[model samples]
Target: MIWDAVIQPFADFGFMRRALLGCVAISLGATPVGVFLMLRRMSLTGDAMAHAILPGAAVGYLVAGLSLGAMTIGGMIAGMAVALLSGFVTRATALREDASLAAFYLISLALGVLIVSTRGSNVDLMHVLFGTVLALDDAALILLCSLASLSVVTLALLFRPLVLECADPQLLRSVSGLSAVTHFVFLALVVISLVGSFQALGTLMAVGIMILPAAAARFWATGIGGLLIAAVAVAILASLSGLLLSYHYSLPSGPAIILVAGLAYGVSLVFGPAGGLVARALPRRHLEA
Candidate 1:
């Protein structure tokens, strides 16, 4: 009975199988991007960029009526624009990066809502906001798989430059003139990952898998490699748990997955080895003569 309850959903339903695959693909690709975002202290930037893609997706819906290719292209364009524009603003103005990001995402979100209001029904809007993970078809799967492959490869090639740039921008620039190229390319990869994930997690909640797992991993891992491994593991587990919870409890799959990741994050916060609440709360001893 326990086995049937827990495992039968995927065994019985093709949609469930597809959804699981989609989540796993997303975790494989997006969680690493999340790790980079966390290391750059740009977690909030991921959230902002996620929102910035909305208007473009809404425009795609208006143009193509839920066409996967159209929305993906549009979202990618919008996200890249916001990222570049925000970077330009940070360099050009006294306003900090966070402030610029906040300003841009708000405008983007409002524009998206207005566009959806004028062009689409409430149901369409909800689908964009929450996603249709269980309804993923062949085209969606192909897009996600391709995106994951590309993101992983790109990250591997750029790893050294990215690390150098993050660690010391001046030093990296002095060593090579690839600093600007590296920054933009990294931003592009982030946008692609978010676009790929939008179908499973929606634009609003897409950052959950990326940020949450990476954040939890920070609590447990002292080194960058360990952090990436821990984050990917957490994301995969959360995806599985969320899918099962959604199946049995009749919950929304995207939110369910995010909630599971959130639960993991909470547990890590309390008991993680690095700097958890328990670690902080434990009494310290002094050396005696």
Candidate 2:
């Protein structure tokens, strides 16, 4: 019964297997970035960057139809451009990083939608906005797995400096010249993860897989390492559940996966032990005299 309900779907369908693999890769790569974004209080920044990729992707689609390489490259270029430009604006002007990012992303989003609508059909627009996980080809799968591997390794190298930066940016800048480098590199990782995942999750919903699990994990764990682990676990579980739901009910895979992750976040908000509603609501024990 369990096999038919849970395991057989992947076993029987190649597309299901591919979709699972793609989601797992996103969970591994993007969730860690999401964790760091949350720690840095830049959660909305992820959403902005996600939107920033859309115009580039739309341009790629306009030029090359649906060529994965073109779209992925365009997305990376666009995301990096926005990140760099935002950083520049923040440093050069009185504007904050978040504000700069918001401006760029909104512009990018509108421009992207306009480009796509001008050139492509509503179906193409839907694909760019929502993704086609079950239709992942070999090239897309390779791209997702390769990017995930690179993200994991890069995060491992950046772990110490990143933690320090998050906890005490002043201290890190004082001690190490790598502060700026680490910041840009982390942004690059974010861009790469989003570009790679946009193929499977689309521009609009890709950040959901990245951010929601990390948010949910916040309520479950205190340590950075624990948070990373818990977030990845939550993401993977949501992916599985979402894929199954989509298969059985004909739901849109991207939104379905995000909805499942959102559900997990809601549950953790209420029941998680770290600082969840239940924990906060419980009465404290009296201290001994």
Candidate 3:
């Protein structure tokens, strides 16, 4: 029966179907964002923004009582605010990047929890920490898909400038003709990743959707395009497996999904085609020949 749960996640169950769709849609948006995050040294931005969405989402629920659309919009606003604050903190303080990131995630989460205390809703706080995939629905599916599509389209158009600016922010002034539009566009992509993934992974761990896969893919590929392809494939496959495993075993879906992604990252750490431990070790022996 446990095995059947894995194989049958796509069976006639509505919950299972929703989980699968969420996995697919999330990866579609997150993969490119993951690439950019990896390049920009802002991977934690996803994590920070995810937590920041919480207060807004909870407040929206207080106002409207579980209308997902309102809740999500609120979450998006909060996410945008977090992104801006992260940048502001980094700039205005002598604090290091990691310090600023920690401030954003921890403080925002505390604020969210405080607001939730006032709402009188029994919405499981644990469920927010680790999402409940079985509760997914058509409205969420549409929203996630639209966000993903917008992310992909915008990224494709701004790919070159974004990559260039990420490599050298100083080029903003030097490139005479190049607008710093790439920075704005990349922020927009991060927003979509946060918004699109919130329902699946919630505010706590959703950054895994935008970080783990890329981290894993780094071992297997060198070029940006190749790394992105590997990242997308790993994220989708892990998400698919994790959702099914969680549904069958009654585990928390979001963390379970992230665990799967982490496992993939571990695998790449040890066995990836390019930079795995084995790959580095193998070259030494061959050189001795």
lDDT of 1 at 182: 95
Candidate 3 residue pairs that clash? none
Model 2 poorest ten-residue lDDT run: 278-287
What is the Cα root-mean-square deviation between model 2 and the actual structure? 1.2
Expressed as tens digits, the lDDT of each residue in 14-122 for candidate 2 is 9999999999999999999999999999888898999999989989988898999899998998899989988889879999888898998898888888998888999
In order of TM-score, best first, we have 2, 1, 3
Give per-residue lDDT, candidate 2, residue 287: 92
TM-score of each: 0.95, 0.97, 0.88
Best by TM-score: 2
Q: Whole-model lDDT for model 3 versus the true structure? A: 0.78
* Per-residue accuracy of model 3 over 1-289 as CA lDDT, tens digit each: 8556666667757788888887788897877798789878888776676777888787777788767787788787776676667666776888766777677768777888888886645554665555656788888888888888888888888887887787776776487455445655676578768767877787666789779999998998899998889899998998898887787788888888889999999999999978799888887544654
What are the runs in model 3 whose C-alpha is more than 4 Å off? 1-7, 86-106, 176-180, 284-289
Model 1: ten consecutive residues of lowest lDDT: 280-289
Alpha carbon lDDT at 34, candidate 3: 84
Residue 277 deviation, candidate 3, in Å?
1.2
lDDT of 1 at 135: 94
